[model samples]
Target chain A: MTKLIRLRFMFAIFCLFVSHNSQAQTKEFYLTLENHVFTPSELKIPANKKVKLIIFNKDKVAEEFDSFDLNREKVLFPKRKSTIFIGPLKPGNYEYFGEYYPNSARGVIIVEVNYVN
Target chain B: MLINTVILFIKDLLPIFVLLCLVSTCITPNRVPHEKLVYVCFSSVVGIFAKFYYLPMMGELFDGMGIEVIKTLELVLVYFCLLIGCSSLLTQNMIAAHQSNLTIVGLVIFTVINASEFIIFLDSYLANSQSIRDVVAGLSIGLGICLSFSALLYFSLHWFIKKEFFTLLYVVWALFLSGQISQVVNLLQQVDIIKSSGALWDSTKLVKDSSEYGHLLKTLFGYEAGPSLEFIMLYTASLLLFIVTFFIKSSKKQHYDIDRV
Candidate 1:
């Protein structure tokens, strides 16, 4: 009985930790991919802040959003949206591209020190 | 388009080839049956098809974090399978059957994960139908490069084994597995399943992580240009786990042999 109570307590604590870590509410940004191109080609996000990036692929074919600079990769399905969290980064230009259409689908995430949200 | 296809193929398929080379160096022919190869091929095909159809829907789960979660789980499983296989290799007492089974399972899972990404690219290209020639040429070139690399690595590892550089080989194996497992940190962080941290250091100027060299290093060593603290810790822990397990099992087997002698 005591052991069971202790197990339950631990489980509750674990759940609390997970929820707390995942719930910090970061600023969200949206990018749309159409005709194998990322719109705004240059997105400016606040420097040194972790932010949510929601990318929607409006094309009929799937595209992989790959960024060596950001250390991120995601397969954006056709007409579906995908979310990736990036940054808390130093101010710089991080280039990203669609893996399947790199020549045409390219963009850069500009992290600025003076960007207003 | 042709260059992009070549890069994509290398980025996605190189890891599978590297893994095959590593495992081949570790196992003897009699230890792994011929039938297991067939099973791995069948499983990979089925797994890729399943992932291709189901992954997009899975992405919708957990508030758009499903793919990350699934990949993380798959990576963790692959790590354990490698652990068991490594242990079996180090210890004489472990049953051969278990080792072969674990190897097949690990290969199947890793192949499915890597090959499915390539399949996605191929699917898109087929849909477009405009760049079929380029795609075919790129695939042929990629296949040649991958095969050449795998052959070179396999022979080099065998040379190391012949030279009795067991410790170096063991360390390389451990680092490779750890590096693969460390990817889970990025996946979890992407979905906010784990707390995100800033990169400990940046080496993008030295070696871009998307370049051909980067893909090769990442496949062989799990090289990350801007790994976070969490990634480092996980990597070190996994490396230690593999090393410790190998040594402990090795010592036990040595003791058993001495007793029998």
Candidate 2:
């Protein structure tokens, strides 16, 4: 019985690895944080498609890129680039902000069915 | 700024409070473990300070993925410790002597992980000479909310225990750990160690993940407004693993008792 349980546990882990390696290529988008504000405060991406977000924090201090709408969060060290993958999302607006500078560093990810590039 | 600080406080600190309440109410209800509490507090302070200082240096490693990698390691350690602790508790109907040490280790690791982010935030604000008053006020309000919620949750769990609702309590505890371990997927994906997928569903209209209640639920039960397929699979698997392990150990213990009789 213990052997059976161990085998099942291994199978589950194997499935996770398969899923991880089976992903197709995703589209890429860029956003920059400068003076505590996100550039292009609105970003557009295609609906129902996975995309990568490359965020650059240009300030001298760190910032955390937080988006409750997208269920993503990552810390962006100053002058360093960070990456986040989001969405095969429904067409709508998803808001994001800098956790450290929430009042000033805010942006929205606008997913559109007809958005190009 | 005050509101932001308050929100940040809740986001970073609520998990620690919830974990403390869960441990106290579920694991050791009758007597307060003052020594364990002191150890947790001391270790958390030391861990947070060490991380705050070394984090910037760590970020410079792994091509800037160092922090994520380190945080993932810390989380993984917490997960294993929890499993061992839970297994022991289930088999013995109490924490075995040495297993109590593992439980304390898990609590210390968890407290450190949850508190380090807030410490970093506070340090950054203080370094920039940001409004101390705002930070203080926000912290006070955040503390009050966390204490009140934790107190309510503690009493509720105690009531459940008195009512002999052990199954429900165990299920909730398992869910909490699974929810936490599932976060490892998100962290790994953030650092590109694991592939990220599209969310399985969206429930933002039902509960905005940014709202106060959303944060509360997220901390308490690992609630996500939108969860990816990977997240769901991992969550389910971990939850089942915990439940199965507990039951298996429980049955073996029962057999041993019968043999002794």
Candidate 3:
């Protein structure tokens, strides 16, 4: 009877830990759009999760979200939030730049994944 | 434990190991390095050309001219080139003295590894899709070509008696490592060697051959450029992983005094 109770307590602890981990490892994000130069100059995602980027175009003119690093391209209208899906990726840093304003729409997705050596 | 792991790994690649044995049975190490070098050069040109130019043309010609047999033949040749790539790239320092057919084994394994990469890496892109079936079908069909190419390479490299498989494999691997395959594939696709249904275009994921590290990825292992961040990240890790595998294999060879002994 005591052993059974101990097992139950352990199971409860495991469940709690799993639940906490799920919540704790919330998908982190860092997104920015350059107004003077490109649309989204910088983008970041947690490595290997389905990345949903909501890039807001703050510039007056239409801008394209482009990056060699991320392999995504989209047109972001001024004052509109556009989303680009990026991941479930392996770990590595990639560089992306705005195609419309190559001079300005530059950013990097510093995908920091755990235990990726 | 170590011995078991080694045995299991060999068992896993039993097919290539047997093929290597069979190849060595009918041959002895040749004394003609000069002739082998020429073939290596030939392997490089032929392999690279086949990968870049011939593949897409065959794909297009199959579609346009409806010559399925020719297309199949071309795919076979691509595999041959893959074997050739591996054969050529191996320096003399990585083989066991008892290993008379190191070239063939290396090339086949290399092609297998190459084919595996094409299969495994695409999963990262497909896993997240709402429609798993569609992503699977797309990835399979595209990568099926790679498998066919690798298998064909296995056959051609193994069966070709006069041709040293290692030299050929080395050259082809070099060309492949140069990132020329993707560019050639891209250019060929642009010219309609293979036509995308453009259904994949619907996905925002970009698999271009011309991104920053795109060429690097491509040359190393046929990684397409402009892939979604997911694809890029996965590919980079994979590339690193493969490089590590190569290094490990080399170190193991060194430990055994396989070549220098």
Candidate 4:
């Protein structure tokens, strides 16, 4: 009886944790382009919500968040900054990378709905 | 303001329209509108997703196809043009513009300057062992990406651009012309006549010859960035021949008006 009671408590606590995480607010994402590559190389954002993307390229070379998939091409010059206002969109995985380093300059923009939403 | 809107509409619709026409012949009557609509609509919508949501870097994978931020405008324009010509629905105006008039001069210029872009697309598509399944998979993926992008862009333009016709027409014209130029350049590369121009041409590399990348590019449209002297010469000659006719026609109108309206 005591073990059963303990198990119920743990299950309740786990549920609370998950519920809390799911309801958390979202914020705009920022990416830094240093050394000719995106800082995160991979990113995930909430689906169907506007996210502001601020890209800062600090390398001497020019970098761009370009993708045939995303249909977006924006250049980020050395130490330069740019903004991409996107999303509030359908759920999907989008990939982009720098034109310079096609192989290494790659990343994912995953748009997903929160479990609760 | 309205100009912008109309411009947006044509730019958005032209591709869908063209694609529909291309696939029309092969489609059964029952499936024609519905299937084509779905294909074009899907492709356009996917284009938007691919554009803003994903980033598949170019130049690194196979090269020349990378869309640098600085090159966005040109790339978009190129996409429009390529879609226009590749589609079977090109109107008489479109063909006329490509063949002889200045209506598509902008596209023609853009295509020539950005000829390397198509090469990249070809390279990526062919980035595997030559097999039907691989080819189909690559095409499917690419089409999905392109469709998503175009759809989102179209809707946004509809909401934002609103109602302009001439601008839309012009943009469409530009797209049509540019695509043909890419096709012409690509075709030149396909025929050995361009490649066999001689050893002087061998100095530069256009597509990734011998690499899976090159094979993909070659299959898409003969993308030889670093080519022998022959390819370059032929490419320039063919482009020039096309360009000259445009000017000759324009000049003829200006100088020899035989007392007619």
User: Which one wins by DockQ: 1 or 4?
Assistant: 1
Q: Give per-residue CA lDDT, model 1, range B1-261, as digits (tens).
A: 788888888888998998888787776445677777888889899999999889889889888998999998899999898778756556534347877788788888999999998999999987878899989999999999999989999999989878877667778778888889998888887777776778899898998787777888888878998888888988888988976887788888889999999
Q: Name the regions of candidate 4 deviating beyond 4 angstroms.
A: A1-27, A115-117, B1-104, B111-261
Candidate 3: residue B108 lDDT (0-100): 41
Calculate DockQ per candidate and list them.
0.55, 0.40, 0.03, 0.01
True-vs-predicted CA distance for residue B9, candidate 2, Å: 1.3
lDDT of 2 by residue, B1-261 (tens): 788888889989988888787778777543335677687778878987887777778876886678777887887788777777656545436566556677788888888877878887887576666578888998999899889988898899889878877667777778888878888888777666666677777787998787888887888778888787888888898888887887898788899889999
**For residues B1-261, could you state the per-residue lDDT of candidate 4 as single tens digits?**
122222222322334333332223212123323443455445444544444323334322222223332243444455444443422122212233342222132233343333233233333324434543644554455456446655655454444323433234334333333433333322222211122122233312443343445433433334444444443444454445434544554465555455445
RMSD of 1: 2.8
Tens digits of per-residue lDDT for model 3, B122-207? 33224445646655564455345435644665566565434645444433344343332223222222222332111122222454
The CA lDDT at B159 in model 3 is: 59
TM-score of each: 0.92, 0.87, 0.27, 0.33
Error of 1 at B82 (Å): 1.2
Q: What RMSD does each model have against the real structure?
A: 2.8, 3.6, 19.6, 24.5
Poorest 10 consecutive residues by lDDT, candidate 3 chain B? B195-204
Q: What is the C-alpha lDDT profile of model 1 across A23-101, one tens digit per residue?
A: 4578889999999999989999999888899999999999999887887889999999899988778899999999889
**Residue A64 of model 4, lDDT score:** 47
For model 1 the local lDDT of residue A58 reads: 98
What is the descending TM-score order? 1, 2, 4, 3
Model 3: CA > 4 A from native: A1-30, A37-44, A115-117, B1-208, B211-223, B226-261
Error of 3 at A9 (Å): 43
Off by over 4 Å in 1: A1-24, B92-95
